[model samples]
Target: MRIAVTGREGQVARSLLATAPSGIEVITIGRPELDLANPASVLPALAAAQPDVIVSAAAYTAVDKAESEPESAFAVNAAGAGAVSEAAAKLGIPVIHLSTDYVFSGEKLAPYVETDPTGPISVYGSTKLEGELRVAAGNTDHVILRTAWVYSPFGANFVKTMLRLAETRDELRVVADQRGCPTSALDIADAILAIAARLKADPDPALRGTFHLTGTGEATWADFATEIFAQSRALGGNSATVTPITTAEYPTPARRPANSRLSGDKLAATYGIRLPGWKSSTEIAVKAILKNAI
Candidate 1:
């Protein structure tokens, strides 16, 4: 089957390409070929690819900076998604769009389900939520997979940031108040492909809805950092003492959700797919980073 991936050079896209799924032709479109900020780029790109399935991994993910650039965020996340969905609809193809857990207000202590009402606290969250709505509305065959705290070997992410910061600084502080599953982009890419492959086999209208996909475990930023550094030391990498701090201690332009944990029970029961624990996924990412560094 032919599958076209947006944000082709992104961390997730790169992983999907590296771990290219079996019996599938992967077409990657990035930056100059298709920019999410430019809505006009989406349809033409989709038409050019003429893919059986379109996986939109492209997004304006500058969380903190999004607060000041809400217009650009909305344009890319919302309008851009709408364009892709509309184009897919024309081609009678199914679309898989990546979303975020930030769409929620972060009030629940437990894992978030797909049915929960969203109340975004940040501009980035609001924009992504808008994108989800537009995609859902524009296409009959659409799947919005909302994941959180995504980290990978391919791009700039929290894990890389912590690792880089820990190198020069002996002591590091990370926010402890917020919690979420640190999903690996490679895992997410696998999940997306599994769903896409299934959809290709049997096009079901019932499968068209928003679903949450994440790692099995959860942790705060501080806890996650501690594990990262601990693993780094075990791997013979640099070691740094990571201190815990509240979200108030380190403020950003965008407000982060306190609870970004998402439930994958639905994904398992429906798709018959299970994701690995954060530790295992993080280990893979660490190894990849180390290999690249060497």
Candidate 2:
């Protein structure tokens, strides 16, 4: 099967390309070739690739920066996403779009389900929610996979940031009030490929809709950093002392959700795919990064 993914350098797109199964052709487009912000580039680029399925992985992901640049965020996350879905619809192909757990207000005491009413707390969340709506409206054969706390060896994510900071700092203060699952980009890529294969084989209505795809467990930023240090220590890498702090202590332009945990029961029931625990996935990513560093 041929799969066309957006954002060649993104964490998810890179993971998909690196771990794609044999016998599958994966073509990635980004920047000059397929800029999500430019609607005119969507159809022609996708048409030339002629993919069996489209994975809409590109987005303006600067959470704090989005607060100052809402227009750019909407242009890429909302309108650009809709344009991709529309192109997929015209080509009569399925499009799997990655979304965020930020869609929720994060007030729920329990993990969020797909049916939960959305109440984004920040510009990033709001734009992602709008993108979800637009993609659904543009194409019926779409799978909106909402994930959270994504990190991997590639890209500028929490894991890499923590490691980089540890090089100079003796102690790091992380927000303890905010809690969510730390999903590995590699795990997400695996799920996306599985979904693509299934969609290519069978266009089941039961499979088309929104679904929560994340790591099996949850943790606060403090807890996540602590684990990262623990894993790094085991790998003979630099480790820092993690100090837990409240969200109010460290303010940002964008207000983060206090609890953005998403349940993966629906995805498990439908796709029979469940991601590994956050700790295991973190260890895998940390080890990979450390290995590459040496």
Candidate 3:
């Protein structure tokens, strides 16, 4: 299958390029070719790529910075996402759109299901939520995959941030009150490929819809930090003491959900796919990032 993923450098897009099976052709389109911020650039680029499917993985991901740049976030995440979905529909192909756990208000006592009411508390979250709606509306063959706490060796994610900070700092303060699953971008790449395969095999209406796709386990930022440090220490990389702090202590311009853990049961039931536990994935990422540290 020829899969055209948006953005050549985003974590998920890079992971997809790295992990795609030999049988499938995964192309990463970016810049003048397929810039999300430039809607006019989308359709022609995808048409030229002639992909069997599209993976709408790129977006304005700066949570805090997005507060000051709502227009840019909406332009890329919402309007641009709609453009991609509409492009896919024009080509009569399926589009797998990556989303976030922030769609929820985090008020639910348990892990969120696909049916949970959405109440995004941040501009980033609100834009992503809008993107999901637009994708669904734009293409009947769209699959909106909501993930959380994504990290990989490829980008400026929490794992890399912690490692970079730990290189000089002995301890790190992380938000402990906000609970969510820490998903790996590499694992997400694998899941997206599998979902794309399912989409290719049959026109199963069951396969297309909003679903939660995250790591099997859950953790707070502190727990995730501790896990990263454990992996780093084991590999003789930079490690730090994880100091637990409440969200209020580390406030950002964007108000994050206190609980953004999303359940992957629906994805498993629908596509028969599940990502690895976050700790295990974190170990892999930390190893990749710190392989040459010693």
Candidate 4:
């Protein structure tokens, strides 16, 4: 299957390109070729790719920065996403769009289901929620996969940030009150490919909706940081002591959800796909990153 993915250099897109199965052809376009912020560029570029399916993987992901640039976030995450779905609808293909856990208010004590009411706390989350709405409205054959705490060896994510910080600091302060699943981009890519291949052969209406796709387990930023250090130490890299802090202590321009955990029951029931545990995936990614460092 030919999969046209947006965001050439993003973690998910990079993982998609690297880990696609033997029969799948993954083509990524970004910037000048297909800028999400520019709706005019969507149709022509997507038409030329002539893909069997489209993976809308790109977005304005800067959580804190989005507070200061809501317009830019809306343009890319909302309007641009809608345009991609519209173009996919024109080609009569399925679309797999990546969403986030931030759509929730994070007040829920338990994990969030697909039907949970959305209450985004940040501009980034609000824009992403709008994107989800637009994509659903624009295309009938769409799968909105909402993931959380995504990190990979290829992108600027929490894992890399912690490792980079450890290079100079002996102690790192991370928020312990916040809790969510830490998903791996590689696992997400595998899940996307499986869904795409299944949809290509049979576009089941049962599979066309928002589903939570994340790692099997959950963790706070502090716990996540601790594990990162553990993995780094095992890989012969620098490790730091993770000092637990509250969200208030490390305030940003945007307010993060205290709890953004999502349930994966729907995805497993429908697709029989489940990502690895957070620690397992983090270890693999950390090892890979450290290997390159050496």
Candidate 5:
């Protein structure tokens, strides 16, 4: 399968490039040539790649900064996503979009199902929700995968941030009140490839739609940090004491979901795919990071 994934250096895009199986071609399109903020550039750049599938992995993902730059976020996440789907529709191909768990208000007690009502509390979440709608409207064949708390060997994610801080600080403060599934970009890449293959193989209506794709388990930022430190210590790398704090203690411009756990049951039943638990994936990611650092 020839897959043209948006964003040259996004965590998911980089993971997709690294994990794409043999016989599957994955091309990344980004910047000057293909800018998401400039929707007009999307079609031409993507069409030139002539991909069998388009993975819309690019987006304005600065959660806190998004509060100040709603227009920039909306332009990329909402309008940019719509353009990609429309381009795929014109080319008679399916689009697999990467969305977020932030679409929810984090008020629910249990893990969020696909049918749960969306009430995005922050500008970033609102723009993503709008993107989801536009993707559906622009292309009938679309796979919108909503994931949360994603980290990997690459990029500026929580896991990496924690490890970096541990290099200097013995103790780090993290929010304990807010919970989410700390997902690995590598695992997401594997799942995306599987879903993409399935989409190319079959035009089954049951296969295409919105689905929650996250790590098998959940954890708060503190819990996640604790686990990362544990893994790093195991690898003889940077380790830190995680000081748990509440949301009230650390305020941001964008209000995060207090409970961001999402259910992966639908994705499992449909695709026969389930990502590994966060701890295992975190260890693998930590090992990779540590190995690279050495």
Candidate 6:
């Protein structure tokens, strides 16, 4: 089936391009030719591509900057998403959109379920939640996948940040109070492909809805950083020490969720896809990064 992937240059999109499944006929559209903010460009691009499925992976993800640039964030995340969803609806095609766990306020003690109430604390989260609302409103045949703490071998993420800092610093401080799972972009892409194939084969509009996608285990930012350093040391990269700190110690413009864990049970039950443990995926990612550095 033909699939058009937006935000072709992003880390997750790059990973998707690098490891996309065979026989999928993937077409990528980046900026200049297909700007997400301009709703006028969306339908025309969709018409030209004539894709059976559109993957809206493009997003304005500057969490901290979003506090001051709410308009820009909403323009891309909400308005842009609405455009794509509208186009897909017009053409009788399905859309698979990416979302975030930031939609939750993180006040809950347990992992967030699909049906849980959304209460975003930051501007980024609020805009993303708005985007999901618009996309779902525009089309019924759409899949909104919410993932968190995503890291990848190809993009700018926390894993890479830790690796870089480990090279120069003897010790690094990471927020231990904030908790979530570190999901790999490769795993997310694979899951997206599975959902796309299933949708292609089944074409069930009712199967489309919001679902949480994350790694198996839960961890804090400090826990994740410590694991990264440990893995990097195992791979003979760097052995920098990581010190745990509270979120209050490192304040940013955007307020992050202290507990961002998401439940993948619904996704597993419906899609029959199991996400691998974060540590296993991190091992593979760290090895790749180290090898590339050599």
lDDT of each: 0.88, 0.95, 0.92, 0.95, 0.95, 0.89
Give the root-mean-square deviation of each candidate in angstroms.
1.1, 0.7, 0.9, 0.7, 0.6, 1.0
Q: How close is candidate 5 to the true structure, as a TM-score?
A: 0.99
Runs of candidate 3 exceeding 4 Å displacement = 292-294
Q: What's the distance in Å from true for residue 266, model 2?
A: 0.6
Candidate 6 wrongly placed segments (more than 4 Å): none
User: Please, what are the lDDT tens digits per residue for candidate 5 over residues 163-238?
Assistant: 8899999999899999889899999999999999999999999999999999988899999999999989988999
Show pairs that collide, candidate 5.
none
Query: Backbone clashes per model, in order?
Result: 0, 0, 0, 0, 0, 0
TM-score (C-alpha) between model 4 and the true structure: 0.99
Instruction: State the weakest 10-residue window (summed lDDT) of model 5.
Output: 155-164
**Each model's TM-score, in the order given?**
0.97, 0.99, 0.98, 0.99, 0.99, 0.98
Model 5 RMSD in Å is 0.6
Candidate 6 clash pair list: none
lDDT of 6 by residue, 184-251 (tens): 99998888888988877786655789999898898998888888889888777996887888888999
Off by over 4 Å in 5: none
Q: What lDDT does candidate 3 reach at residue 216?
A: 90
**For model 1, how does the per-residue alpha-carbon lDDT over 1-294 read when each residue is reduced to its tens digit?**
888988866777887887775788888897787887777787888789889999988899999899899899999999988888888898899999999999999989899999988999999999999999999999989999999999999889988888888779999988999999999999988888889988878876666788899988999999898988888888877768978999999988888899999999888888887789999899888877877776
Q: Global CA lDDT of candidate 1, please?
A: 0.88
Q: List pairs with backbone clashes in candidate 3.
A: none
Residue 62 miss distance in model 2 (angstroms): 0.5
